[model samples]
Target: MLENIRENSQGLVAKIILGFIILTFAVAGIGSYTNSVDTSVAEVNGEKISQAEFEKAYQTQRARMAQQFGEMFETLSNDANYMAQMRDSVVENLVNQLLVDQASRDMAIRISDERIKQTIREMPAFQVEGQFDNNRYLARINQEGFYQSSDFRDYLRVEMTRRQLTQALVSSEFALPYQTSLLTTLQNQKRDIRFATISAKQFEQGVEVTEAEINDYYLANPGRFENQEKVKVNYIALDVNDLAKDIEVNDSDLESYYQQNIVNYRQPEQRRIAHILIEFGDDKATAKTKIADIQTRLNNGEDFGELANALSDDTFSGENGGDLEWFEAGINGEAFDQAVTALTDVNAVTDIVESESGFHLIKLTEFKAEQVKTLADVKEEIAIAVSTQKAQDKFFELQQQAAQLSFEFPDSLEDAANAVGVEVKTSAWLSRFGNAAPFDNAKVIDAAFSDLVLNERLNSDIIEVSDSLVLVVRLNEYQAANTKPLEQVSEQIKTILVQQKSAEKAQLLADELLATHKAGDDISAQLTANNASFEEKAAVARYGSDLDASIVREAFKLPHPVADAVVATTVKLNNGDIALIEVTAVSQGDEQAPASFEQQYSQQLAQAAYQSYVEALREQAEISKRENITSTSQL
Candidate 1:
């Protein structure tokens, strides 16, 4: 529904509110959401990071990754290495956030209440038809599964403070005009060069690999040919989706669900209004007198919108003829909300009302009554919800039974399968890196190879594979790691040895040609004598897609020529050919940079400096990790 709300709205309200709402569902990033707990998972500058916070963040990250990777997401989530890294990253971010929070307070960074209100009013989300609407603001904030206005304000305040401090640190970062121009010249510089290729394949006919060499190579790198460790498991599993298929929902159940969760289908009343405010800041009598004149003008049949546009003190609302669009009660303030709601007729002007901002003369323009959906209108949705609930209940019950039975009968999975009314299934040969269905889960793989399951022949604990699935695995067979014999890999080693010797010969030829070119020898005549292919490139810049990126990058590395100098160097191409390059001429690029280039260079330098500043802060701060709580066991 919130997603639907965002899709239907085209204002800043959707952007701001949806960004926050989506963040709640996002599980990919590090760091914890604000939470309260007594037992500490870590401590930053004497501040305890609670266990609840760590668990929540860890699970959220796991779930987010699972969703992102689809089938492979579970494999990554269950990986011990991945889990460890994610946990450490989350803790590090939390510590950094705490450091920033402390710094913000120590520096006396403050955001006033009025400023907060103004910021909220200025947001495009709260505006309708180019002006701030209090009702729209209230509607967005009132949506469930998002932060309350107070909490959101606090978040915004902290974010603003952090941004202010960051900008202050990097605000002075700049690149000089001369520096940018110099770099631009180098980036666009082109070179005229001729390259002669010496192919390794030409030398391959002369290269030979001996039987003894192949034997030696195979013996030296035996581990390279070793077979991976593999396991087979027999498991009893319960999946929630399977249970959901059997779930039954009656019409009465649907009716009961609709009655209980009816608010989800409720549409609140919305009001559109135009108003004239005369601010009484430090001078009430003057403001009252001004409002009286406006009231008289309204009584004389003058257009209310035109008058409000010209006279209202609220600049944002005044720009749109004091139009505040589509809002429910409690959005602005109690006094203002009551005044707007009490109006019964369109174009009716209210008596002078007082609020924190000032005195207001409210005029109603449009209204929409509250609406509630009939039970029949939402019957299918209710039925689906009721069925899901029942399915979840059955799944939990089966999971509990399976867990208990698996523990009681640790030697075999047959008893657990019988108890849970599930079949014991056998898996194909599973390896550590394999990502097959069911057995792809890291937890299942670890449990299958665990000492208890392998050596003691005990049933593993019930491992939760995903939100919908659980597995109790018993190892059926195991293959010990072993290296393949030298005979099996001798032919493979021979091919590699032959290629290496050929490449060495080609490089030697390229080097000889390079020395001749540097010594002022006629390499073009030498290349013609040897029947080598010589090709000339008129101009080549620092970047291009048509030529080899590696060769192009190497061309720029050559120093500028002095007095008709011929600089030579050799590069190994991807096809095992040696490219011996000799620069005959060079053209330096323009030194004056365009405006866009200058801006880009300046921004790059600023970003680099900001990263350095952040790193320095982390290095200077005192950081500590809890001994009992590592990423591996946090959850």
Candidate 2:
């Protein structure tokens, strides 16, 4: 279990720290400080992990995990083993971070202030309406309990510097030509074969099993027969939907609401506009002179479409002579949009409008006027609103009646249902964690497991399942743990035996098909006669775009196509079918593949080499730090 946990470090760590932090901050959140504290727990060279620093770092990790998991924290917090695993991860992460920080200082790695600001401005979290918002940035920092912007900036700078150093150390490593060629050779391969599977249903019809064998299997697996805890509850429910149906919407109020929100009933006029654009940067004066020349040509009655096609900097619309499709107000830049909207008629041309995208000479090709919808046109919408309100009112009325009955009777769900004019619903017997029927809701299951309902046999309190439904329940009776009799489980055991035999038969048939193909017997005719399709995938790369890379990798390892060295492979599908493959052809290409495909494979190989280098560096650094820490503590 620990080995599996180690393999999934990120998932395990996230689960462990799901809820602990209400008051601590992680080192990543800490601002810069020049002074070292004496209460350091461990040091990487002269750098210290002070007790205060550790507490802060721990708290930040806790808060981050809590936010990510939200309400699921209860499930994680209840697991003691998971929590312990998370603590170990936190310590390891902190130690590695300290080492990396110290190494950056020793190597004199520094990140520029401009780079730090640029990174912060690009962060998606600090953006408001698609652009960086200063107020949002400050609010986020304040929410995280940071006092100053410079403090957060300095921390980010150090982390960035450390990352740069790691990248620099690892980037030079590359895979050898021999390794690359071997990988490519293994990718370009194909499989061809004919096969059939003997399904379990085919053999299950006539299969027989003795009663004694079923009894023996049941006796050996007593844990499977143990009765799970169950519950019943008696309660009252308040359904909002029922109440909403009885509520009324007055005609005057509907008219008033419509008048107040009249804008919703009207559609704004839109215009189709296009423009010849000239962009300006540092050479603003030169760009202005060029734009003026184009305007002069246009004033002289030169063809706008011809001039735009030849002179426009907007490539996206230039090919169509600067013809942009229809757009509503606020769709384009404010200055450009305002100028276009001001045009009084279709085919109107406006003076050059300056915007962030540069200067644009606008042409309005078409226009649409606003159209307002009448009250009669939206009657169905009003009807729905009225019905929803009435249903909510009725639901609450039912809840009040049921609540009164529960109070009066104090013992029966039936009495409460009778008082509310609703039917009493009883659920089938269900295990505590089993999804047996409608009673499978987690909240309902938790309520069913409560001591009062499960053991005391008392009526459950009214519980809200959703806004529209409420339920009261009670445990009727519980079955105790006992081994199921042989007669009860005989059919299940027989089915299992049939499936096992079917799988073995399928494997045998697949093996024979491969053997026949290897012996130079053509199976294409047999496959075609059986209505099985044959596909030929040529020049398949190791990192195949369409097929699974793992499948392609295995396929390429077979002997050359001419040799007919068939390699049998079986793919275990999620749906219980074994996809048997027999390799028929294999080939290797010398050149790097196309740019789009080659780049992805190159990056994968490069990253793997880089990660291996970083791990080696980290291991050596850790060993040296451990020795030094031990010596200092002894002293």
Candidate 3:
């Protein structure tokens, strides 16, 4: 079960820990916590949520975010709104869990130990070859840090019991047939429309931005005219490839390494054997009697090959006169191997021996003694491998020393570089998105900008660029973010202003065309006179991946029109053009399920109902926090 939990429930383990922590919240009142605990963070009913538990959950969440966001973790961690939302979510999760526990007690929900054991046994992680293995279950549980099986089972019991209650609350809720049909209809609805675009570029000849407009726009949007902050850095790196070139291996060292790892080059002893078996299954006595009769034939000097071919119950080997070709130990069963090895005389049959396979008679045909390669034969290969291993070891050792030296003398990388025997390399100016060799690592960039490294100008903590490399950097020069001068950005701002004016003119003309077209005027002719053509799209749906998506979206939003009536709508396209669309016909989709829509709708309805059920429980529960506990304030 523990193996299964580790394999499939890595994420669920954190959730289970959260559930356990929440279950610790008060059983009765705050007074009980006041007398019984000083380290509790919150109290619900009379149970306590410990400070340690809250810190664990909070730290786990932070670490998870750090892994997911990398350098972005620093920005998100400093966000006040994000932190507050995270804290509230954690607190509400605890509250909801406590309420569920309370509900479970009120409803007297229970799970039996036998059921839990069966569940554990059935878990894939605990099974070997699809059957439960007790040793694997025990080893996995201990490896996962669950020392006591009872506690692990109890933890699972809570989850199982809660799931049962959750299913009971939500499983009955399902979408009605009419509701399902309506959803399917809307999802597959199609509209026939005609659309024409008024390109923004068409107005470019007439639209112009003056110097005053450019100045006004630049002043209004100062953020768009800012220069990026840049920094140059000095760094020392330890890479295995660089170290490997300097590594040298002597013949003595190669021979020593090979001698110590000789087992890897030695082949195991092997034996070739022929055997016959009568398997004991439903009728053990009958199988034993049959094997005894076969052994009597061996004693009577009957040909073993003929006897095996006619009488041996082992099918595959029986056809070939029971010839089990060369195999090493661990291949055949222990009992069979022991019996076969005991027969020292060549081609001599052994007495009937009982094994897991029932009864067997065996003869050894050929044997191969274990052999090892000579030092001369593998010396060159060993030397190269030995050199590589030594180099990798030296790289890691030097990296560690460099990391320590940088911290002990944070002002410069000189001492650290000399200690690691590498030169301090300087980089060109780097921005947040710079991709120069080692600076391509986000960790290196983030550390270079860190407060201690950037502002205080100290050596960075060792940044692991890859498995084979580690880097330590210090800022050499800093360029604070500043705004570009008005003169320098004037032309860029002018182009933006001109484009904005052009798009506005296009939208205005398109709107005028739409108004005139809706009032029975020939807008297509008017657009043709204005150097634009009306394009027709047939049977476009609300959710299609095509060029007419924008027009189709706007057309569907308009109310359905009567026979001979056209519905006019205008939509803005991504290319900064305005599309004037006219819907001529509307069609409802057939009332039929699309694949597994029924099952999907049922699941969504059940989940929504379950969410509501949980919310209702939370609303009714009495919850409190320990005033003295502040360490877990974020949680």
Candidate 4:
């Protein structure tokens, strides 16, 4: 009976038994009612971390990882430590999700169906032309293997609730001003210095090497000497675009589509306006006074364009007399747009409007009223849209025909092609692992390597390369692997020897230069005579430009720069030039910062603190996980 219970524990019968036992005890205080209920794997909190749920989550994670890494998945699975790490990661993620669900229940954080709908409507993926596309949304959901919209919506709701809980926890944490200021200062501080480089190329002209040494090096590295095999293949590719070009759209179709979707052809109302913007200074009262003075000037008949040219801080627009040039509604902030749109007359000046940028006085120059476009105006667009639809439908028909052909003549490519009214084409000699011509599809390559093609002269099954077309291929011939003689690689070996000798000579010269500089000997004349230039860098902070940041970090660790004392630094340039640098100076910058900058810095620190707090919470949430159960297991 115990063995049977263990085997059937994942079935619906076991769930019914467990449910019956709980209900029987609750109603009548029944004791020892069920001998078949296996509850040993249940959690201390009375929540069943069902074997099925664990296996599903585990398999999902495994498949995701395998898809991401491909062939490397096998290598990763072979390692015990890697498997353990993956298991732990999956378990942690499952536990966090469970904890989020518990927290949502405890806090009564309800996500409404309407909110989920609104969220989906707002999502850019589901939107077409700035509005939610119901067909596109449904099609995308269907493609993801969900049978119903309600199921997908429920998943989205759970995710949204989890996100809200995380946001709440983060918002509750506070960061201090002092911490913000320190971080801001660190972020903004810049470093300034002077340095010179000694390159390997400068000393490489004198280096010499023998053939015996090169031959010995090559002998020691046989694997590196092996050449990779390459092959050329011939194939007829069937791409969707190819079929789309051949598909035609008539005038009637275009006109019909344009009439059906008229809203898509209408343009929004737009306005052309100019403005005189006055930004607030440090003090609000003083800034307001300055703004009032600007308003008085505008009222007293001062040219708005001339005033904007003089006072506007927006460099891009200021040059053109604050002309923002044909802005549509909602392009600018709501306040600015409302103020601009309120002006009925072309010469009318707007009253002072306040925004984050500052107070703004505007003038309406010109406005283009919205127009519902005629069929002629959008003929080209309509034609393209209609053509695309026709092409898709034709492609679907072709796929059906090809599928039929494949069914009738499963063993012959020629017979299938004859049935579909298309010519049969043969591919050039291709190896099992060779790249498929034009289309590097794994499916095509796998078809080429199937037992029928590799060992027997059997035609490949119809392989759908893409949405538009299917391919049926038969292997023609095969090529055996070949190795090149050692004599063929002798020239390559000679070039390698030359580069090695050059690099060694350059290193020796760089070492001597460093020693000479350390001994307080002036080498600037020698450096200048060799056509080398000195680069002066300033205020390069830790997270500055990549090159300067790397150099600065290394230079600061060295002793203070002194006259004739060069701190030699070797860096590899992207152009294959090896640079050996001499550090001339290094100095720390001032650490004073503004209050706003400090606040921004503190926000970043708070985010990091919140992440650490969440990780701690997840660790404290005790979770036990089971694995390898069948789909029949119930929660």
Candidate 3 lDDT (Cα, whole model)?
Answer: 0.79
- Please rank every candidate by lDDT, starting with the best: 3, 1, 4, 2
Give the C-alpha miss distance for residue 423 in model 1, angstroms.
5.8
Whole-structure CA lDDT of model 4: 0.65
TM-score of 2: 0.55
Best by TM-score: 3
lDDT of 3 by residue, 1-635 (tens): 88986766458777898677766664445558667646766677777776676776677778888999886778787887787666556666776777787789899999987788779879999787997654455456656655445456768899899888888877798889999999999888887888888888877886777888988888899999888888889999899999999888898898899999898788767667777778776788998899888888888898777777887765445666777666344333577667777766568777787765568888777777789898888888898889889988998899889989999999989999998888999989999875677887778888988998888889999999998989999999999899998899998987787788888988999989988888787877778866788888777878854865677677888898777566887888888888888888889987797779988999999989888988887667666865433334444
Of 3 and 4, the candidate ahead on TM-score is: 3
Write the residue-wise lDDT of candidate 4 on 1-635 in tens digits: 99997889879988899999989777664444544455322242345655555567778878899999875676687787777677667555666667767777779998987788779879998777996654455456766654345557878988899888877776666656566556556556554555555455555575665668767767876666664432222223344566787887788898889988998988867677877666554666666677678778888999878888887644335557777666545433589889988887887888887765567777888877888989998899888888888877776676566666655655565555555456766665554354554335656766766776656656666677766666766656654455445577667777777776666655565566566766768767765765555677665566646564446666555565566455666554443344445555454444566656655655676688767765765676665555422232222
- Top candidate on lDDT is 3
Query: What Cα-based lDDT does every candidate model obtain?
Result: 0.78, 0.63, 0.79, 0.65
Pitting candidate 1 against candidate 2, the one with the higher TM-score is 1
Name the lDDT value of residue 440 in candidate 4: 57
Question: Model 4 reaches what TM-score against the true structure?
Answer: 0.51
Q: Estimate each model's TM-score.
A: 0.58, 0.55, 0.68, 0.51
After TM-score superposition, the amount by which residue 454's alpha carbon in candidate 1 deviates from its true location, in angstroms, is 3.2
Q: Write the per-residue lDDT of candidate 2 for residues 1-635, one digit (tens) a residue.
A: 99987667568566567433422444424533534445555565456665566556666666788799864665785676666555555555667777667767877888987788789879999886787655456456656654345557867887798789767755555556666656554444334432232232343455555667667766777666555554443344556665564567778756765677678878878787777878775577777887788989988988778878898865436656777666544434588778987997987788878865567788888798989888778766765665675676677777777766665665577888877766666666667655654466666767677676777666666666777787777767666556666667667776665666555554555566557766778766654553343455655665544754444554555444454355556554343434445555545455453445444566677678756754664676633222212112113
RMSD values, in order shown: 17.2, 17.9, 15.6, 18.8
**Candidate 3 least-lDDT 10 residues:** 626-635
